[model samples]
Target: MPATVTKTWKLFIGGAFPRTESGRTIKAVAGGTVHHLCKASRKDLRDAVESARAAQVKWAASTAYLRGQVLHRLAEMMQARHGEFVDAIRATARITPRKARDEVDAAIEHVVCFAGWTDKIAIVLGSQNPVAGPFYTFSGIEPTGVVAVLAPDASPLLGALALACPALAAGNAVVLVASERHPIPALVLAEAFATSDLPGGVCNVLTGDHGELAPAMAGHRDIDAIVAAASGKRATALKEGVAENMKRVQVVDPDSDFTDARWRSPAVFRGVTECKTVWMPAMA
Candidate 1:
C-alpha cells in the first residue's frame, strides 16, 4: 500500500504560495483529516498590501474589456475545480454535499456575473454632465487602488468571492483575509486564481485570525478601501482604525446570503471605485 501525501496549505501572495514569515501554523480539521495552514502575521499583511498596490496600477491601466476577459478566465478556472471546492466546503463547513455544491456553484456564477460587469460599468456608472458653460463635462469611474477584503467564517468560498468580485471587477487589486475558522475552502480557491489568466498580485489570500489582521489592514496607508463581511466589534475596529487616513470602509452582514441578487448589483462597485469628473473646452 502506498502512503498518501498530505499537503500543507500556504499563504497565497503575488500569485504564488509561500509560507508565513513568522513560521506560524494553525491546525484545521476537515474531512476527518488534520491539515496545517500558514498563520499570517502583520508582516504578511504588509507584503500583501505592497503586492496589491503594485498590481493595482497595471490592472487599472488595462482596458475594461481586457479586465473583463481576465475575470472570465478566473471563472473558468473555478469551474474546472468545482468538485474540489464542493468537497472543501463540505468538509470544513460541515454542510451536506448538496448544500456545499450549491455554494460552489453560486460562487462560480457570481464570478461570471461580475466579469460581465467590468466592461459595462463605464456605460452604467459614467455619465455626461451638462454644465452652464461652453465645455464638455463627463464623470467616469476609476479603481480605488488596493482593496482589503475580510471574508466571513461561514460560506468561506461564496463570501470571499462575493465581496472580492466587485472590487476586482472595478479594476482594483485585492488582499483577501480568509475565514479564520474554516480557511480550507478559500485556500483551495486560491489555487484556481494562481492558474487563471489574472495577473499576479491582483488577488492575495491570507489565512489567520481576522482580529489581528483587520486592525492592521485598517491602518494600512496603501490600502485605498475595505469591504468586509463582518459585524460587531470587528467591524467597529475597522471603522475606528481608518479614521486617520479617511480610508473607505464598508461592512456587510457576515450572515447575509452571498447568492442574493443584491450582491450582483452594480451599486456594489461604488465603494471599490472612485468617480471622477472632467471638463474640456468644446470645439464649435
Candidate 2:
C-alpha cells in the first residue's frame, strides 16, 4: 500500500509560514480528517507586529493606483481559487454546500469592491479648505500603519474579509486574528494572500484562541489601530487594553450582515486612516 501524505499547517507571518513559538497545536476536524493548527502565542504576535511595522511605510508610500491594482489582483486570485475557500468554510463552519458557496462568493465580491475603493477613497474623504490666508490648505487621508483585526467566529472568511479589506485598501498593513472556532477558511485565505501581489507582511494571519491573542493585539504599541468584529466582553477587553496607546479602536456590531453594501461604505475606509492637512504657499 502507498503511504499517505499529511500536511502540517503553520501560522502565516512575514510572508512565510513559521511554527508558533509556544509550540502548541489545536486539533481541528475537517471533512472527516483531523488536522493540527498552530496556536499562536504572544511572541508570535510580537513577530507579526515587527513585520507589519517594517512593511507599512513602503506599502503606504505606494501609489494609490498601484495599491488598487494589487488589491484587484487579490480579488482575482480569490476568484480563481474559489472552490478551496468554499470547502474550507464548509468544513470548519459545518454549513451546507450552498451556504458555503454563498459565503465564499460574498468574500470575493467584498474584496473586489474594496479594491475599487483603493484609488477613490482619498478623493471621497479629502478636501481643500477655504481659508482667508494666502496659503492653500488641503486635508488628505493616510494609512494608520499597522492594524489588528479580530475576525468574527460565526463567519470566519466573510468577517475577516469585511474587516481586513478596508484596512488594506487604505494602505495599512494588517495582522488578522482568525476565528477561534473556524480558522480553516482563514488559513486558505492566507494562501491566497501569499500568492497575490500584496507585499510581504502586508497581511498576516494567526489562528488560535481569541481570548489569549486579543490582548496581545490590543496592547501592542506598534499597532496603530484595531477593528474588532467581536462583541460584549471580547470587544470591551479590546477597547480597554488599547487605552495605553490610545490607538484608534472600532468595535463593529457582531449581528450586522457583512454581505451588505453598507460594509463597502467610505466610512470603513476612513476609519483606519488619519487625516493630515498640508499648507502650501498659493500663487498670487
Candidate 3:
C-alpha cells in the first residue's frame, strides 16, 4: 500500500507560492482528514502589498478591453474546474452538495458578469463635465492602486469571487484574505487565477487569521483602498484602521447574498476606482 501525500497550502504572492515567513500553520479538518494552510503574518501582508503595487501600474495601463478579456479567460478557467470548487466548498464548510454546487456556479457567473463590465465601467461611471469655459472637460475613472479584500465567512468562494472579480475588472491589483473559517475553496480559486490570464499579484490569496491580518491590510500605507466583506467586530476594526490612511473602504453587508444579481453589476467596480478629471482648451 502507498502512503497518501497530503498537500500543504501556501500563500499566493507575486504569482509564486511561498510559505509564511512566520512559519505558522493552521489545521483544517474535513471528512476526517487534516489539511494544513499557511498562517500568513504581517510580513506576508506587507510583501503582498508591495507586489500588488508593482503590478498595478501595468495592469492599469492595459486597455479596458484587454482587461475584460483577461477576466473572461478567468471565468472560463473556473468553469472548467467547476467540480473541484464544489468539492472544496463542500468539504470545508460541510455544506450540502447542492449548496456547494450553487456557490461554484454563482462564482463562475460572477466572474463572467464582471468581465463584461471591465470595458464599460468608464462609460457608466465617467462623463463629460459642462464647464463655463471653452474647454473639453471630462471625468474618468482610474484604478485605486492596490486594494485589500477581506472575504466574508458565510460564503467563502462566492464572497471572495464577488469582491475580487470587480476589483480586478476595474484594473486594480488585489491582496485577498480568504475566509479564515473556510479557506480551502479560496485555495482552489487561486489555482484558477494562476492559470487564467490574470497577471501575477493582480489577485493574491492568503489564508490565515482574519482578525490578525485584516488590520495589517487596512493600515498599510501602500494599500489604496479596501473591499471588506466582513461584519461585527471584524468589520469595525478594518474600517477604523483605514481611517488613519483615509483609504477608500467599502464594507459589504455580511448578511447580503453575494449571488444576487444586483451584486453582479458595474456597481462593485466603482468602489475600487478613483475619479479623475481632464481639461483641454477647446480650439478657438
Question: Each prediction's TM-score against the native?
Answer: 0.98, 0.96, 0.96
Q: Write the per-residue lDDT of candidate 1 for residues 105-190, one digit (tens) a residue.
A: 89999999988999889899999999989999999999888999999977899999989999999899999999878888899889
**Candidate 2 ranges with C-alpha deviation above 4 Å:** 1-4
Q: In order, what lDDT does every prediction score?
A: 0.90, 0.89, 0.87
Give the clashing residue pairs of candidate 2, or none: none
The better candidate by lDDT, 1 or 2, is 1
User: What are the root-mean-square deviations of the candidates from the true structure over C-alphas?
Assistant: 1.1, 1.4, 1.4
What TM-score would candidate 2 get against the native?
Answer: 0.96
Higher-scoring candidate on TM-score, 1 or 2: 1
What is the per-residue lDDT of model 3 for residues 164-282, given as tens digits with 9 covering 90 to 100?
88789888999999988899889988888899989998989899998898778777878888998778887888788667788888989866798787787767777789899999999
Clashing pairs in 3: none
lDDT ranking, high to low? 1, 2, 3
Cα lDDT tens digits for candidate 2, 176-253: 988889988899888899999999899999999988887777788888999988777888888986686988889998
Steric overlap count per candidate: 0, 0, 0
lDDT accuracy of residue 262 in candidate 1: 88
Judged by whole-model lDDT over C-alpha atoms, candidate 3 comes out at 0.87
